[model samples]
Target: MSNTTNFKNLAPKGLRIIEQTDSLYHYARVISNTRFGYQPVSVAYCKDASHVQYCVKFCSQNNKAFRIRSGGHQHEGMCSGNGVIIIDLSEMNKIEYIDNQPNQAWIPVGKQLDSVYTELEKEKQIIPGGGCQSVNVGGLTQGGGWGYSIRKFGMTCDSILAAEIVLANGTIEIVSEENQPELFWALKGGGGGNFGVVTRFKFQLSALTDYVTTFGLTWKHPEDVKEVIRVWMNLHASTEVELDPALSSSCTMILANPDEKDLDCDGIRELEEGQKSFVDGRMGGQFYGTKTDLIKLLKKCFGEDLIPEDSKFTLLKEVCYASKKKSLAKSEKETHASLARHQSILANFLNPTSTPEQEIRATNECKHRNYRVLPVAPTSTCDQPHPHKVSSSFPKKYTCDDNSEMTERIYDFLSKCCYYGDVSKYMSFHCLGGAVKKNVDKRVFAFSDKPYLLQIQGWWDDISNAFDNQSRNDEYVKWVKDFRLNIAPFTEGSFINFVDQSLVDHPETHEGLLELLEIYYGENNLSRLRKIKAEQDPNELFKFKMSIPPLIE
Candidate 1:
């Protein structure tokens, strides 16, 4: 936007505008704040697409900053501005379905996740979305939405059939695969607010089943977690993988810091400084099929026989365990045994004193209804408190050995930061095959080819004044980066949803964030995006940190 701007006499009728120093400044700022940094000059409540168009034209004519806000859950607050105009679409939170087109619907950017779910539940339909309930559809879809039904359906972007956008020239238009195909393609997993102000999105929906079966498995023992992870990476998380489409689960675990002192946390059971951090690993999700089929698929985690193969667990009936010096059969048996032993350990952790319960859990992996599949309510602030710095690694290839070598590396990396007593840090591994790989171009869409997404999350829950405790924040930031680098060998690349400042805008870039841009979106896609940015938003209107840079700039 041009710098020679003037807001005097700019207020328009039918627009609810809140200027700085207004009584509603705090509320307006919160709505637009990324929880990172924000101090917009004013926020204009847009009731519809026409208002959004007016905002674009108004800002363009005035040469002022302008960014759009729906849910305001951007990792780096890409929708925020310092002293700019914010097109708040909160009033436009509306949804409508196409007649006889149960699979297609039109939703606005301001609608929250939970609202969509609650409304869809009434119709016995569902839209694949993130876990957080308050995340707006705009940010989630643009960043490639993931949910409990991701494998069954696809990312949220894949569901988008069309979008209603207000371009930089104040021209409102519809973009779909058939019209403005390039811009439409860019909107899907191409990052939001780059092409235009997305007021409404036409999404494809999926029908929900009656009483989805939720399942889960946990591993508490350190050694068991290591082996369990290895088996996962080898089978489910593997790139050359063939998994049951009905079954999709994430293998996530966290290591607590053994050295965490009682004074450091509240409500947590106190432990000695030297005590090792407890390891907690869980995997499984709601299955769209019967219990029998789900069981068979889960059994693949261990040898088909559900027997322990480790040398420690003696196989009762094994005549010749492969003849040649530890033959293939022998190795396979040992690996199977290791997995069973790990499973047993995990089951026991869940039922410490009840041997019967532990045995049953190990025998029956699928528990009662998969824990309520829900999304965390998003915070208005930019640097979200739950996980301050979330860096994700999407690996299309991986190597896992029965010796538990691969999982050990993951454990070694995880147990360091989330260890010492911090329960906030975690490593999440998601199965990436199924529908995600089928729709859209895997090479272009983020995390399409990479079947396994690893989220290395760091929390800022020290309970101290964040503003005053800059050093503490820095500590966690450093730990997150250091740990990510250490596991870089095992990691394929980062996920765009879990943005990293260091990678997105690396300090070493000559004059721009060129390096991180290519890293986020591959070179070809990034180039195409740049050209779109040039042609569509020549004035560099819609932008923030990590957005596509226009050629004119």
Candidate 2:
């Protein structure tokens, strides 16, 4: 722990290595809040790719496992506690336009989402990305970045024109379809930290439209829950392709805040206030719930009979049944109105009840859920084309749509697996769509012939003694694995940002990996990548928990 320690003697000349007793927690919580594993041997902060190369060489020479760090927001906190050397990429923040007319920019992998947005605004360019302000572009794009722009633009990966990567053996290489198409496809929607350390990315930038609109709508009362969902689904089915709405929903339990709740004896006003209070408290507490794909649930709730089967694969589901009681409290006036009309439309669907109170009681007893839906923004892509690229599994042309679809798909899968139980909602991004299915050779993401839509989501709350904590975690992991297992048969790939931590357990979950190989190396892509891995750094100097296989020696 000393400044003059031998450990310091091995450090890179210009790199910054912070090794101290106080650094554990700082490194431990980088971006992931999940449970931890064995802590790192130490943390090393690299100023640039040169430093990263130095760390990789050092680790290789000394024989050590190393974890890459960019934004600490890694879902499972995999960057820490692996008993490896932590090469923190959070310090490498640089954004510069490599070409302006073509709208291309070179961004360091360490930049955060907020910083990127702020900077892009200044540059009069925007790369549609995951809206969560805290997410790092490195982790998000590598993990299949999705956000408000996906539906309108496509995914962040779609915008990736090229990248500078330092492979496991400490060899620096520029990865693009023309240079190393296989590696390029894998990195797009393939999940990061697995392939190698991404020093800088050359992204295709797009002009930001002057007209941007945002909207918010809320529904109250338990009786209206099902109706609201039904209406929302119906609306989305015929929704104008130009209008994208991010959707979300939840059920609540009444809270005891007197200020929020009034004495109910006076009437509906008190009841309405009480309902608001309950919602606020619910947000304050752990939400026991689920977030599902609007497209999928639209089919589930309204029946798949309406949507074409070919399009069903585009639908996603995330379900959650809460152990806590769902509230049905409503103002007397609202209840009275619903009861009056109950017999006319939905009345036949339920047990015929005479009074408003009876109707509320019946509706409460029935299943009720809430939802939210939003459209993804469009992606930024390189201008012109890189034609020399000759891989079957790779896409010849890069665009924002590629990244949008992948991220939205992952959002659907993750919402189903991680947050299913207390409440449910849906969201979508206004992204580029018409070009999703374009068959661009046999390259990666060749699932369809049209542009794709993207969505984003967030929801969850803890429940004490709800389900055994250990059991819940185990169940969550299993659920994610099961989905990954089933995903390949239906679609070409999934969203990278929503990449599950259990990718190691089910390699098939990453259909993009093999597909990229097929496109880049043709029939022998994996073999070629392995051979390149060997030629570049003969010794496997860098590593991640899961990665492309080394050449079969």
Candidate 3:
């Protein structure tokens, strides 16, 4: 940490370097609230592959540990560390589509999800990616990106045709199935910052549809919450129900917040002063079809009576409808009304303080659109950084009736945790097992065989409060850890994308790096990854607390 002066001259010409003395150092250093206090020696903002190579070479020569950062959204903040150099890739944001092959594109590792989605939508194409817009393609694809369209097209890593990586030796290599196949395989879902610095990814893109339907349904009542969760899980895991591959959904069960108010078509309705605490469950996702077809599919899955009356649904194409259209059928009018309702709900869902005027403007702007535009702003939730702790796992398949004890335990944890602190807490069940499990043998991403991905999350808004109040922050972190432990019996393997540092710290759950690797990559895949790590980065220059180390010779 003391040799800070050497970094200034080590940075290549045209590369921007922010040392501790620089005014922008603080801003460049902290990416996530969890890593707010991590003070890096310097942050090198690499613009392209050459700059990345220079930074890698600098770190190698100085024998200084450096962390690779793209979107900087790593849950545990391993993308950064205290008193080390950070090779920041945010400046290398660019996308180049292949001329004749419209279905393929080379995206820089620094490109965030929002820009990627917006750029691809212009070409009527998209890659399967997570919902968080600020997440960079580097870490996301490396950890096996999951999104609403995953059930249709598979993971983001699955679409990776090739990658341009700077190895530990400062040598650049473009890896793919046809070249450096083992390294390429390891790149897919092997976890980021494990192997080397990935400069860009050559992705095999999928055609983007114009009229996909997105829906949201909330069940506030306790009995209704349990019933919705039961039905949703059954829809994904039940062999008796022939669920469509075109539909991908997730359910979130949130512990009731005393400060939260209910907002409906009427407006905000305050909760009763001393209302008993309960869990609120919401199930919703996108369908690659029209509203009419989506309604039919939902009815088939939930039955007519089970479908909530106030459920919100809308078509992506509805945003492109011309306001001056001559005549509308009764069904079309209902669909428009539904779109309006959806906008209202979405605005409030993202920001409760959103004014009625903002809601109307959001809906009205959508009416005159000509091209396909994303209905909801993908960056709404992730625009600002907050202190959060998350742990994820692939849950084993279980029917509603067969897992009564597990269900009760999950509910019990959710209900009891609300009284501990004011942090926002929820468990999200992301449906899997459609295209996710199709070609598992060809990729390193493990746990596709599991029915769904369960993420236990806790978020705190005030960074100052989080750092100052140790006990308060501990309550939030402990809640996530305790909840994850409660459901350990029902889950198989951990998701590398939602990496947790505590897994390595805890002795009971994992003995050491080997056990942690097994939890993240499975036994067989872990061995393969270790061998590849040895071959590509034998020196272990790219290493962290949870990073995969080279196999001992």
Candidate 4:
């Protein structure tokens, strides 16, 4: 029989197999980074655990290489590769709640963050997850997911109660602390596509608050970039001000644009007409509290000079209206009555060019039942595929004197980096603390005690024409590489979720796979992870470029 006939015979009934001849095969091959020409032989769309088992068996018996794809959001495109069979779980997404289990739910690995968030909101529950809505629970949880609520609730992996996985031998196993303890520990924050294919996760959910206050503050002047970083770092550490544990924030600094008309990868111009046309810095996050309390906290931390008294009152009234709260007294409304004035002040400081109508529409869309869940701005870009590269590091807290030097280095890069066509370059710092420091020995996720995670990211449009101009791609790629090098001394370990291929493939270092693994899981955790890999996948059937290898006996 032919290869196609053999695959069809082994596949379960109703399992869709998209071959290279099929029209949808091209679409199946596209990942987050379209720059790498990954051409999979065929894509097997698995709908359930049975379908996954059959595909794994076929690949094992036929000696065919395969890669597992949940959301295809892997930074380096390791989820799909050239000439490999793709086992896609996009069709297997489903959320199930157990009887009498109010604090937990079973989430299929293929479910994206947006869908999970919407479904969990129905029960007034949440799981600490990443900002990008398209990132699926499988990869995010496996790589120690970070989010705006990270400081309060900890990572997505920390919430995992158990997981159902299919081993290379086509055996299904439920892994938890009691069952297969080593494998269970490895599954939590040991990186995706390593040992087995995780089909579903039983997550321990947290109670969602009735209301949340989301705030954004920007420093427009290039000269104030250092001060912005210093203050933001102090705020994250709670050194200058005693912050509430319910608050979590991130700071981002964007490279200045050479031309005013150059659009970013999001198709928005960084330098607006009336806005300050310089290196822009923004600090924003979600606060599980009322608008009144958030305003008080910000004013105390940032001072009245940066956050004027008038602007604070305007923000308070705007959030009250957006949330549709009726608690504001009529006399208080009359005291701060100008709605247009509130929106104008917010537009000037927080979100540029935002009107009252736009704010209301966005707020209404994010509303779940009666509760208000405000997502941080720059919402989901899942539909738009672009070429991008990211490198990350978890830096420890520095003293005031040390912070000054680090701030200067970061400011220099943001001010001097070259901008390519339609490329957006920035550095993001996600604060880490509070509950993240509670459980250090339960999982393989390292760097939980670190202060924050920093990501050096670059994205550009026109993915179809990326290869036509090699120099443009090189310039953008080199910019991120150089920035990573500049901050190498201050940073320690890298985040596995933000995997970078250059760490192993760079010409200067030529670091081995083991060295790259050390950077992600540390030396001690990596040793245990390899042993579990040996137990689960002895033949290395489920392997990728950055996957863990079986320990040699």
Clash counts per candidate, in order, are 25, 93, 0, 0
Question: Candidate 4 has what TM-score?
Answer: 0.83
Alpha carbon lDDT of each predicted model: 0.62, 0.45, 0.72, 0.71
Residue 111 accuracy (lDDT) in model 1: 89
lDDT tens digits, residue span 1-553, model 2: 4322444576668776665465455443333433333456677778888888878777766676777878765554556665567888887888876643458888888887667865664434568666455567787877556554554455677788899888876788898989978777766755567567898888888654432322122222322323433333233333244223233221111112212222222333232321222111010001012222444443464354433343232212222222132222344223322211211111111111111110111112233222222111101001101000000011122233433343334333432331222212122322233223222332234333323322222222221121223443454345435544543432333333433333333445456545543432334535555665555445555444344546647
> Alpha-carbon error at 540 in model 2, in Å?
5.2
* Candidate order, lDDT descending: 3, 4, 1, 2
Considering only N, C-alpha and C atoms within 3 Å, which residue pairs clash in candidate 4?
none
Model 1 Cα lDDT, one tens digit per residue, 287-391: 665445555566665554332233322111111122232223544444532321222232222211101111111112212222122222221112233325667
**Alpha carbon lDDT of residue 494, candidate 4?**
89
Candidate 1 Cα RMSD (Å): 13.4
Best by lDDT: 3
Tens digits of per-residue lDDT for model 4, 201-273: 9999987565566666666555455687787676655545546768777777875434444333345444333
Model 2 TM-score (2 dp)? 0.56
lDDT of 2: 0.45
Q: Supply candidate 1's per-residue lDDT for 392.
A: 74
